[model samples]
Target: MFSTRKMWLIFLLYLFPYANTAQDIIFGQNKFTEYQIGNMSLIITVPHGGSKQPSTIPSRDCGCWDMSSSKCFFTHNCPPGTIKDSINCKVSTVKDLYTLETALNLGKEIQKITGGYHPHIIINHLSRSKLDVNREKDEATFGVPEAEQAWDEFMQFINTAKSYSPKGLLIDVHGHAHPENWIELGYLISKQNLDSGAFTAADSSILFLSKESYNIPFETLLRGDRSLGNNIQEQNKKYLCVPSPTHPGPSGGNYFKGGYIVKTHGSKDNGQVDAVQIELPRWIRDSSERPIFCAALAKAISNFYNFHFK
Candidate 1:
């Protein structure tokens, strides 16, 4: 007969491997997987969903970029006497990873529930400190030369989605840090002034979730209102051809300064590539409120896909 301690040890050895595997799936340390079954094509692009900062990049301002320097440095145009460490610069946070993981989980849920209308996701392997997806090639802070390479990756993802054709949509996921805590949604149209009379018109329409639309629920929630839950309705106010919160004057409550990704890829006229940018407030996925916020966002996106795709 076996001793009690020996039997217990044997049981644990078998159990440990299974437990670790389950944790890995939930935590998403493994490589991202894509699923496809139904004809509908929905591509989810997460530009800022990164946590690993490149070892090659420096966190503090060193100097301006020049040909001679072996390691490239970019100027921030900071005011004089600013301490390198004291300067408030955008840095990568674990929050971004959590948000992306939540999005992946939601995507999986959508795939299973929708019977294989799988949503493809593209996430940046490097942190925003290295590159920002919302900026133009010229405006990139660090990887200015790599802009073409990044664009190539984006195009490749688009091409893969296009294989399905006709019934396709692109979702650009992001997070925002705004005082009012809003989520913005809309598309960027071509401004006539920017064109040098070269291209006939802007070739694309990028759909974005704006800060104004998103801020309402977050502001309300911060004020301790939880009655509506995730069933919050869009306030039917208008500003600059987009929906805004019902407040007067040029600076309407719901109007967010839309970013580059929205401006670049959004076009309704060009064979139905709908680009929607979603900006979730920092507090939504902050350490304290992540579980509830994740559920709420998952439900929101699920509802959006079901309604639009069907």
Candidate 2:
């Protein structure tokens, strides 16, 4: 019997046929500016959903890794379905895409629920394969120069939104590859030794999904005897947080488990702009488990918004 999640995923796969291919798959340096700005209270960014490759870069040009068949054993030889699988595996074919769609849809839902007050979304047109918004330009493999320009645009968007409303919020949307298969929220903190005002400086605030900044119940749940290391291993058993095996930090799991997007944009010191990063496991929305994931995501977002924005 198909699991409820898998059943829902099949239904959506048919609903969105365009998600299955790689041709003309636009990726990096692309920004989606479709939503209206002044009408909302939040900004949503998806930095890793891009899949487009640079025109200058060849199809098989694996950056840094030698493609020459002589030097590398697997040069120019990717396994069949590797690229396609990677795209489908990482990109939000349904829920990721649906999250933004639903926010837009929420414009109507809000009008119905509270008589007004909707949120605005700012998403990247590019895929994670192009430029990872979460990672610094130096860390990206393609369009390093263009990615910098995109990053500037992202920051500018945040500044502009704050200027429009001193009470607005910014959210960086993302997914994680882990074994636990649960939702994770991350906040930015000022990394030790870094200037507080600069974008490079990390913000060290804990993101609370519940209304209160620090919910005792939630904190206790997160602090369950399981160390971070144990959490990662356990998470991977049922979900996909990272592509491969990696060691987490001493605190328990990988110290750098959260991406750069969460580390950079989540700042509370800059009045009126609060940010949080959400990480969803792939199993939740895979071809076999999308329905269950979508419902869970919708509920999570609703809970998160109500806790903070309501």
Candidate 3:
């Protein structure tokens, strides 16, 4: 009963797949990173924590930040005599010290502490020196085929993970060498903005997550008891967090506002997934002290989920 034109259109539609919908997608087999499905609506990504640098991929000409600098890229606050990149690729590309170990360990700790609430964990095993998984195409892969493929694979995995937690949280983990012994929680707003209380949920880096007003002031969600920072603080692990119960912002110090991973895959601008970038200091991310931080992070995540998302 269909017209000839309609039938032809239907045939063409079947012949050409216009887009890949989130529903029918699969994961992990071809991904450049390791991925696992979990019982909880959560995701954690260790982007710049890999130690491998396959010579097949060239060293990124996009210079990185000093491993010892106290300043941050949010305000282009690189110190004198340091590399000032207009590309704004100033955040430390050097792997976040022991982040992979900590993240993996954190996962173990999470299972033990939370009575078995598994969360999807994604770790980019390729070194940043080879491919910056957290950056966009032009800057991320530099148009290299392998890098591009890896980038696509990583993103696909992230999107796939998001499908599992459409209304939950995403935590982008990284390392920082700031002078302070605290975790720098980035909600996309800068240290200056948080200090002045001059930002909106829409202004946050987690666009999609912030779109749905959580029935609480945006600032409160950034640091209150229901906030990720608060739970981490309450754990008494000694690694205090910025914009948390004790500290509102970095004050006179530096902080990473967020990054490509947090902004792109996160519910920035519009989605049910809220994402936060947790930049851990050496005191917490170092191999020796990682266990303490991992335990604290697991508890923080469990507490945050119970109080807010659950």
Q: Pick the candidate with the highest lDDT.
A: 3
lDDT of 2 at 112: 43
Model 2 lDDT tens row, 76-163: 3444333322322232222243334433343444434444554455555544445455655533433445655656555554554445
lDDT of 2: 0.42
lDDT of 1 at 58: 38
Ten contiguous residues minimizing lDDT sum, candidate 3: 19-28
Error of 3 at 198 (Å): 0.8
> Which tens-of-lDDT digit does each residue in 73-128 have in candidate 1?
33445334432232233333233445576567656755665666556665654456
In order, the Cα lDDT scores of the candidates are 0.43, 0.42, 0.70
Tens digits of lDDT, candidate 3, 1-310: 9854344334433533331223222233233456555567788888888777777766665443454663323222335555646354543357678888887898789889878777778777777866778776656765667777777767866776676544888888888888776788888888888888788778775554334545766667777665778888888847688888688878868888888887776666667788899998887776788887788788888888776677
Per-model C-alpha RMSD: 13.5, 14.0, 9.0
Report the candidate with higher lDDT, 1 versus 2: 1
After superposing candidate 1 on the true structure, give the runs of residues whose Cα lies further than 4 Å from its correct spot. Answer: 1-39, 57-97, 141-151, 189-251, 254-257, 287-291
Any runs in candidate 3 off by more than 4 Å, and if so which? Answer: 1-31, 63-92, 206-213
